[model samples]
Target: MLDATLKTQLKAYLEKVVQPIEIVASLNDSAKSQELQALLQDIVQLSDKITLREQGDAKRAPSFTIQRAGTDIGVTFAGIPMGHEFTSLVLALLQVGGHTIKLDDAVIEQIRNLDGDYEFETFVSLSCHNCPEVVQALNAMSVINPRIKVTTIDGGVFPKEVEDRQIMAVPMMFLNGEHFGQGRTSVEEILSRLDSNAGVRAAAELSKKDVFDVLVIGGGPAGAASSIYAARKGIRTGVLAERFGGQVLDTLAIENFISVKETEGPKFAAALEEHVKAYDVDIMNLQRAVKLIPGKIAEVHTASGAVLKAKTVILSTGARWREINVPGEKEYRNHGVAYCPHCDGPLFKGKRVAVVGGGNSGVEAAIDLAGVVQHVTLIEYGTELRADAVLQRKLRSLPNVQIIMSAQTTEINGDGQKVTSLSYTDRSSGAAHKIDLEGVFVQIGLVPNTEWLKGTIALSRFGEIEIDARGQTSVPGVFAAGDCTTVPFKQIVIAVGAGATAALSAFDHLIRSGDEEPQTTETKQAVAV
Candidate 1:
């Protein structure tokens, strides 16, 4: 067993790369196995093509398409597979390469008694930051049955291939190469897939996850609202999220947060978190649901090795920042350029900054940075800014926020250390200019948090989940709300409303079935209704 100090250090060391065991082994024999250690590094660098890149490819996928790599052999991770997560990745690779996690006799028995091997694959993206668990749970399922190969690919780095295969979300999976699934799933349901062999090919397209008594997929405003509704309704509710508060956590201010009218994003998110915590719902943090198997009882497999069974499932795993799709743009993200300007823009205070794209996000970021930086250059690839007229006027009004129209950012210029500047071409002028910048905010657009839903749920052409007015997907039991879902608006209030609708609908479903119990007076009084 590792000592406490060693364990802590090990945990910190894991933040850097995959293969923690190998790192430990190399450090142990660094002096004696110097050549071998060097060889390992080379192998990690050269053979780490978990996903393929066409000769002309530029950026990674919406994130890595942690699918297509195939059961372990071509294992590709959509996100940074580090931290405690490395162990899960290793185990998955070992199993795919032919190995298994030593399960207790009881667990192993469950595996043996399992009717068959239900293969699963989870695609993920590194920027997702919440997708690691989806990768782990699928691996655990694979270990139960080696024949049940669970392939994971990086989605950010392989857009075309995953798109060609029709990948719409991360933590996506395909069972038996035909019945595909997404979001998250429990081992029991995974086994059911093997036993039933239902959606092998039908999974290639998107569809909603299996419904349950309660399905709260997001931990954001909408998700919290739904969870509160279901729990108060006496519905056995469960929630899964990439993180709580969804995109709300990325916002710097909540000038419009209810009751208080104003609050910081994280602060409001924490408040919402506390409220969610006040309920009986099962909430998992830093945990992601990778696949959802539609069946009698929906199974949810968390990256943290916990399997939850719910009568209904809700999806609110919100949106992530859009990218520049440049070659090194990804490799150096957070290293210099960033997404949540609130979290990272301050790092470049007093430094020259450039905001790419002309969308509201980009323009708004430029305006926000004008006061903090010496120079703020807002570059728009289109002929005009797509941001709202107010935002365009505000961006142009900032003396420091320079607007460049008819421009396309070609590459993010950087040194081996950090970002140095950006290179873009003025399409109309046929001129290219390089601006020295300490940071580049690529606000091209927002990619719906629906990539993982590709194979499992139906998605709108714009990449949002397709939900009815009641927030129901094509699948009966599953429901979605938030920026990830295909509702008309992407605002926080809209998402909250969607969550409420989903919860009420799911509650009606449970009551109609009579499988769920009725609510007590106290439970009824708990909700705002």
Candidate 2:
């Protein structure tokens, strides 16, 4: 089921193959095996350098293997590869066909220096945009380390394993049979975990730093932009983020970000990191600022018990999805309720799901989920949908989508294990109704990440930072941008612009106050990290 454009691209990529890849599929009585076999056949048929063969009986199939140049790569796929995971399959093929690895030298060295036998079992859904990055990283690492085996299981294909593992999200990596962290993980992050003597270091703590020229408190688009801009001005810039990429990682399709026609969230997030890494900024990932001190030299206290000092600070902590805190909502998370359609949509393929709220986010999620899910029931508390007209029109055009306006979600019904249905109250009729579904996606409003700055700065009732035109906060040396601020619109382009403005303002303040000083290139370079 390859499209014309994709087929052409794959053909071009395969033409460079110097070696043959033999796919060994273990058959089973289940239809999934037959479907996977058909897909493998189609892929092998497209290239002369590839071959497919069955290994085990239909009744005893458990695994599949691929061999390149007569050597097992130690790679396996436990289920059908589709959705976002399709990239993983393609990349695995390209690697098996002898394409040179594109990893950094340091990362490759890390992979080659590994000591013990490490088997990584990465659980992923076909729809998770962030899953492929981790999967491909592990797959590439496997190419270098024979002792390292990687098994990729499509969480959607085997629901029993998902429940057994208590998997709440995709890219839930397991190393040596223990749970590793989830979400978009980088190569260096994984190396740290494997090297940890204790349990996988949940997060790397930031060391105490004396002072910084510009300190950014978030890792989303705004924080990344601020750090890059400030560092370009020849100053010490530091970014402390709970998780890099912020809310942008939760987004699915981004057409409104200007210049780029289309891109997924996780892809864009990775690009953002790459772009920021090009500059000399000290990026402290997984560090959450628990407290803030405003003065000529602002101080940030992180949850890891490190105190960071800076001359100027920029807040770009970003926002999170507003949860519908009804009965059974929290308990059923990942069981049958999810907030990100791009991350979890494929897991509910051929199953009915519901979308809560009718804002732009909610409607967009419904439209996105409708393509993969069997049915989408959109529930809005307002009398009419508040989404953009174009999004509303597109959502209405979907045959499997149903709209329920002016209804309040009362309780989330679950089978004590997974979400089974949702109950709501009809505002007009004053009647309660229930909709049976396997998954529920919440896409209401966004709660700004200004809770830590409650008494530190001026915040709106919604918890957004109050910033003037210059992006300056109530505190003189502090500024804010992105969704955490009271900006008119919350968009990627706007956040980038706001970040630039905040950096410029911080530079101006340093110049006017005579706190700026010319430094040697060596000193400047040292602090850039």
Candidate 3:
């Protein structure tokens, strides 16, 4: 080991010469060069990391605590954090650290009262700068809660550590020792996870199994609200959804929703999730309802190979985004390429952004981004913008917004750090043009969130589960509403209304079937003195 004197001597000597030339010659000196390289290698190791992975109180199972030093809840990134992943992490931290999003004051107050610690150690390669947003969001969330901490481990330097953790991608997070959800989870979703973990699964599982007063089939807006309302009615309610929030989670934004006007689809979905959890409703997310045998006790078959018995079913299966299937689009989503500008546009503030498709959503995204970002590039495969005339006129009025009609997205350009630009082919010119931008939002349209329910429920020609005005399906005891349903227009207000209607209608059905004996799984009762 070099003594302090030798280290000072080396520093002095190195300061006098240009680094590159000196490094080459000094490295020629076998012993010293080997020593220098070894020292650098060691310094990069986790043990020598300037910042450390957090260790919470350990007592808090459902929540984690953050370690704070000052105003800035010190976060250290060993590598460049520049892409969508980094942005998300930052946002998550901001929310966790008391950064309020575009939510109402009431919602903000409710979230502010939440306290927990989170530590995310995302494994990333030097080439994956596009993933910085995830870290950034996490850090932002940490700021909301002083207990949250997010760290990044350079995969290039620590492949063994990543392998030991079984990390298969550029990004992953672990809460305590157990693996949490994957990909990019919104701040609200992460909070929901913490909340869900707080509820004892066994205690929550103690719902009545024999006879449900109300049965909610879907897990979207309508189903979530329906179950909540019904359960709040002091009646037995059971909810089974492929996933909670149904197609609402699939939505990119809910600006059209009354009173909200602007919010991310996932964040908005999380707000609804908070409402769902505020009640004693039985939730079965990520389980599809395959078949429904409507009768006194409707037997619903699930994709997980489990049969569920409910009194009435509310189907809120949502829709899926229709993809262009172009190469690199899926791989680059949220990595510089995105589908929801509302969810990601803020990251590109004063930076360049892009939007694909000629529909209203695309046009609106472009317009929305134009105001916040430095440049807005719009791509459409058609000869002209297909949005309404007013939107077209406004788009034309914006100097930063470029309209590229008849140009189809052919390829996305990136070094895998983040998307640097996009390449498109112009049918009229038989040529292609590449423009540098930070993001790409696709607005081609979406598939009804009802594909998995083929034999389970009646579906319309558009793949929407058919529903009545009261959100009831063809099956007497089953109901559905929202984007996945046969609602002509998929809007936030409409979905909320449909969800409320389904809840009320399901409650009424349960009341009408009073002949059936009710059941309870509760064993605890007060002693009659």
lDDT of 1 by residue, 1-529 (tens): 2346645654443334332222112123223234323423433343343223322131322222222233333233433344334555545545443344454465455565666555555655543333454566566655454545555555433445554564433345666676365543444444444544323322321123333477677788888888987877755576666567777765655665456787666567768878877878766444566666765687766544445667777777777777778766876665566665543454455779888878877877888778767898888878888999998887777777788899878888777657788888889988989898877877776777666667787888888888888888877778888788877667777777888888888877777777666767776776546
RMSD in angstroms, candidate 3? 14.6
Greater-lDDT candidate between 1 and 3 = 1
Q: Give the candidates in order of lDDT, highest first.
A: 2, 1, 3
Per-model TM-score, in order, reads 0.58, 0.83, 0.58
RMSD of each: 13.9, 4.5, 14.6
Candidate 2 TM-score over all chains jointly: 0.83
Question: So what's the TM-score on candidate 1?
Answer: 0.58
Task: Give the Å shift of residue 242 in candidate 3.
Answer: 5.6
Error of 3 at 154 (Å): 16
Clashes of each: 62, 0, 71
- Kindly give the stretch of ten consecutive residues in candidate 2 with the minimal lDDT sum: 197-206
- Runs off by more than 4 Å, candidate 3: 1-119, 122-149, 152-211, 232-234, 241-271, 277-279, 285-296, 301-306, 346-353, 371-375, 382-390, 407-439, 508-529
Deviating ranges (above 4 Å) for candidate 2: 1-23, 28-54, 57-63, 67-73, 93-118, 141-148, 155-183, 187-210, 397-400, 427-433, 518-529
Q: After superposition, how far is residue 128 of candidate 3 from its true place, in Å?
A: 18
